[model samples]
Target: MTAARDDHTRWEELAAGYALSALEPADEEAFLGHLPGCEVCAELIADAREVMAGLASTAPAVEPPASLRDAIVAAATPRAGLPPSPRQPRRRETRRSRYAAVAVVAAVVLIVVLGVWNVALQLQDRGQEHRLAAAERVMACVEQPGCRAIPLAAAKGGQVPVTALVRGREVSLVADGLPPNDTTGTTYVLWQKTGAADPSPVAAFDVTRDGVAVIDAGRLTDPLGTTEWLAVSHETGREPPAAPSEPVALGTVS
Candidate 1:
């Protein structure tokens, strides 16, 4: 089971093929047999496979044609009719080709990594934009006539202060010392109550790291004059609930 030093280049190519799952049956068998003995090829395969793992999750799904596999096998397979070249020149050429092959694999993996990172950054920027838009809405509501600030009392006598800003049908919440909504399938829900009727769901919101949120609660079932009270509840799901599972704060409409 001795591998000639000169065959390292061929093994490197096979290692890449093994990592990418593109090797022919014979090549795969030979590479597996060689892998336990050759640390260099094992490392190459490990690095390439790590890159392939990331591609599986983030890369768009595309089915390559059957001919593509045939082409790759044909290209990777060394020609049978080649004459033996000078040892010194072949060694030099092999080193260059080996580096080139490794570089290509690295470049492709780099591109995919950058693409995923770029998408994450874009989503973050979009979230910031939404927060800014919500802030602007709160400001707009504040400047409107008939907008009244109502301080919400904590249901359990906690010191966290929550305020409800109401103008006609539009409602916004300004709060401090609220906890983060990290629980799965849960959200902060704003509910409005009129007279003896059950609380009606208004809107859902998210709190920032500073425990503050300027939530634009959309519209109410009744206008500001008719609304009896407003309450914020921590509830499951983004959809408004029929009843509050956990009432965090409440404000009486004056």
Candidate 2:
């Protein structure tokens, strides 16, 4: 009984990581080898998956920059004509190395969320210069081969040239004549609809004094063709709601 309990406990530690696709290769192989007849571990994995599915529905999806893909490829590529090392790093350095790796990973995640201007502000200390550079980047996206420029219509009244540049799953919003966020604390939040699923919140932002705002690069929850349209909602707070309040602007994605 004690041996069985210990075995179940060991598998339980790996269940969540495996479900999250975060387990190391050797551990994953062992877990898969042991899982076929292990009812206890199978039940644990199912519970972890259920929790992950629930969390994914509320979170905004983001696509990492192309530079991240290049970095990963360079790291994974083997050195030419070099023999592989037989020895691993010393155990004493493992914890420090792990922490350093985690910090780099966290910074990469921040880059995806903050976009170019904010990343330059945090890392390079260039504010206005980076904002201009980011705006230029948005303009350049329109020249790209497969980019679609979708114009949004004001829900209340008047004609504003609010455009969304969509290429693949990437999206950049450029807006003019949007009503400025006021003392009432209502901010414009972007949302996307794909097929019959509930509209997913994309980002929350405010416009400038001239009623101009640019979301340099965003990512939709679904693939480009699968997404039906995009909308901007006037949300009460900076924090995104589980569902949008009411749309102030709407655009059909084609």
Highest lDDT among the candidates is held by which one?
Answer: 1
**TM-score between model 1 and native:** 0.53
Q: Quote the positional error of residue 6 for candidate 2 in Å.
A: 99
Q: What tens digits encode model 1's per-residue C-alpha lDDT throughout 1-254?
A: 11364567678777766666667789789889988997777777776666666666765533333343354445545579997554565446655555555555555455545676788788778767756765565576668787877778998997746778787777777777678775567788888888888888888887755545676778888877877888888887867777877689988887
User: Which candidate has the highest TM-score of all?
Assistant: 1
Q: Write the per-residue lDDT of candidate 2 for residues 1-254, one digit (tens) a residue.
A: 44554355445555544654656678789889888987655765665556545544644435445355334223323458898444444442333333333333444444455564455456444444545654675668768898877878887767844678788877888777676776357677889998889999887777744544576547877887887888888888776798987687888877
RMSD of each: 8.5, 19.8
- Name the regions of candidate 1 deviating beyond 4 angstroms: 1-10, 17-32, 39-90, 149-165, 172-189, 194-219, 222-228, 232-242, 248-254
Q: For each candidate in the order shown, give its overall lDDT on alpha carbons.
A: 0.70, 0.64
Looking at model 2, the pairs that clash are none
TM-score of each: 0.53, 0.44
